[model samples]
Target: MKKITQELIDRFYDLLSPCRLCPRNCGVDRINGELGNCGAGLEVKVASYHQHFGEEPPLVGRSGSGTIFFSHCNLHCVFCQNYEISQLGQGQRVSLEELAQYMLDLQNSGCHNINLVTPTPWVPQIVSGLKIAQERGLHIPVVYNCGGYEAVSTLKLLDGIIDIYMPDIKYSDDQCAEKYSKVKNYWSVVRSALKEMYYQVGNLKLSRGIAASGLLIRHLVLPNQLAGTKECFKFIAENLSIKIVVNVMAQYYPTFNAHKYPEINRRITLSEYRAAIDILKSYGLDAGFQQTIDTLYRKAIPEWGEWS
Candidate 1:
């Protein structure tokens, strides 16, 4: 495979000056440190970096995914699990060279891939860092972990840079999306983004039990939201190829400001999760991990070491 280069990095940096990077289309002048709706600028602010074992089995494997948690997000969901980092921007600012070095450090620590968490707003910066890291001999697969509301044009810039695409299909209904994530046209934008992602990477691929390329669509089952889950699965089956790896996550806990919304203000019941699984099975989409209800509350709270 062709390696990411410094020229690519420089080009990405140039594009971020006046950022039109995500679906929000904030067009914030990020180069001069102007904050957008996402509350982020040109420089990357990272909360933490480490090898995370809590991801999907294929991505995590035995070692773990080299996770670099980027601060702030384009779609600031009310029930965000990582609200501290994504909402409050609780992290230190680092240069492109420092971020590249962090990737190398994780690789040296025996991680399987470089997993970028909530990287939509900082896609340009991440791409630049990846190129620099690749030049410095970083060879692990790059995982573009993001919320599903991505801009297709922004993702086009990462055509060859990112190897694995793991995007969350949060909601199938725009009303639910608006009520929960505060994004009005969430489903429409995310559906288009998913199509673009599926077109770019096609179906999921694995080598020796490790994911190298392709898409992994994740749907987190929420309380009193089985119908939404069914709609999302049906759409995936009809629109995209059913051969895609779909992870039906049951790790929904009332976090951040979820209490304000009564519908999703609590943990998902076992029945709710099972109903979602039943819907996926009905569609003949048996591709990814199913989070157990017992395991959901076992570690509900986010730990500092989770970044590690």
Candidate 2:
């Protein structure tokens, strides 16, 4: 009922032939089992799906957000917390029908929304499943939770289908992005993607204190300002309004191969978090959330499942 038209679905699946779902543009025929840079094959692979409360406030209202964690990300960050799923591809390959069932099950369990994490590569398949799920009385809002790297053309296919766009503004500098996430054009791509997403779903809107639709950005403050928080805040304030909800994440630690880089080999200091908060205020970006620095001491490992 939310405009997942047959024509739109068809156009999205066509992208799979050349596999230009994300910015990689691998051109590999994913329909024929050619793997792309995202490490995903033609099959729809899902790491897990559950009512997760570890998300943002509005998304975690009384019933948690129904999060379907997709394996293999478009931007495989070297310091990825869910390295097992994103790097090693630890997930179960599911058919489009099965994926729809998963959505229906989550809705039945009283989830706030269907949160699709790292879903770029499998957009076509996800949309197909969404069509079936919507037809089967699945009406919960669909949240496109993704890494910053996205293609505008691919996102256009999801125009009316996706209600919430929660994306990360990983780096303000392309050089830092290339070094950290192996993406040289990340800054440029994300800017366009964020603009398109904002155009689709304006600022964050809530219904009875629950997020009904909008764009919420997550900016993970890395050690020694490696995330370029200053420039990021400025860009968001100038381009995308300062009133946009932004989650200033402070839970950064040396995860996976992060230790390989000395600059990011340790947890961020309280001063660093304060600096980011200061920048946020300087930009008049008050509509967002920030984590307590004390939580970083608790050793919050990623909730993603094991490699087995």
Candidate 3:
């Protein structure tokens, strides 16, 4: 693998002055401290940093995934669990050097990988930080944890940068996406995004039982929304190879603005989750982990920065 260097990092930072970092195409001049739809500028704002154990097993193996939750999101989903950071913009802005230092600190603390949560809008800035961390001997795999609505061109730039591509295939229908995420063509967009991500990172690759590279697609089963889930899994089975890791998430609870929307106002029932899992099994796509009912109930809520 090609080593991440400071020169590559500098070029990435240069792209952010006129930020076209995400699929939103806000094109706001972030260099002069202007905010776009993501509510972020040249500087990266982080909500918190910790060794997060709440992620999928491989990513959080042994020590835990070194999670750095970035504030604000390109897609403003109504049921966002981390609305305080994503919508309310409650985080402190840090320089690229400072962000890189944080990554090294996490590694020094025995983290498995530097898992960047909701990092679409700040890709360039994060790359810059990763390069800096690399210079300081940060060698752990980098996980690109994002919402599925990503730009193909933006992902192309991240070709040799990211190791593991962990994205949520949120919705498979335009109506559901439009109603919940306010994105008009989210279905097509996410499909294209996932294809590109799969192309970049093939099947899930592990070393010593820890994820080192490849794609791990996540899907949260929502209440009264099996149509989207069925279509999503079908697309995954047909288009992508069956070797890819798929996490059938069953922990959908009413959060953020979900109460305002009647369709998603309640938690997903046991039947709903089981049906999704059954569909996965029926399709002969059995290459990933399925959370137990107890695991879902216990770890659904955020643990407020606790590792393990």
Best by TM-score: 2
Residue lDDT tens for model 1, 96-163: 89999999999999999999999988877787787778888999888999998888887776887778
Off by over 4 Å in 3: 5-7, 10-18, 300-308
Clashing pairs in 1: none
lDDT of 3 by residue, 1-308 (tens): 24767676666666666776766777778888889988988789999999988888788788999999999998888999899999899899999899999999999999999999999878888888887788789998999999888888788878878889999999888888888887888888899989998998898887887888999989888899733788888889899976667888877788999999888898888888888888887775677767776545666532211111
Query: Could you tell me the TM-score of candidate 3?
Result: 0.93
TM-score of each: 0.93, 0.95, 0.93
Residue 164 local lDDT, model 3: 94
Instruction: Tell how far residue 259 is off in model 3, in angstroms.
Output: 0.7
Of the candidates shown, which would achieve the greatest lDDT relative to the real structure? 2
Q: Which residue pairs clash within candidate 3?
A: none
Model 1 residue 103 lDDT?
Answer: 97
- Sort the predicted structures by lDDT, highest score first: 2, 3, 1
Clash number for candidate 2: 0
lDDT for 165 (candidate 1): 92
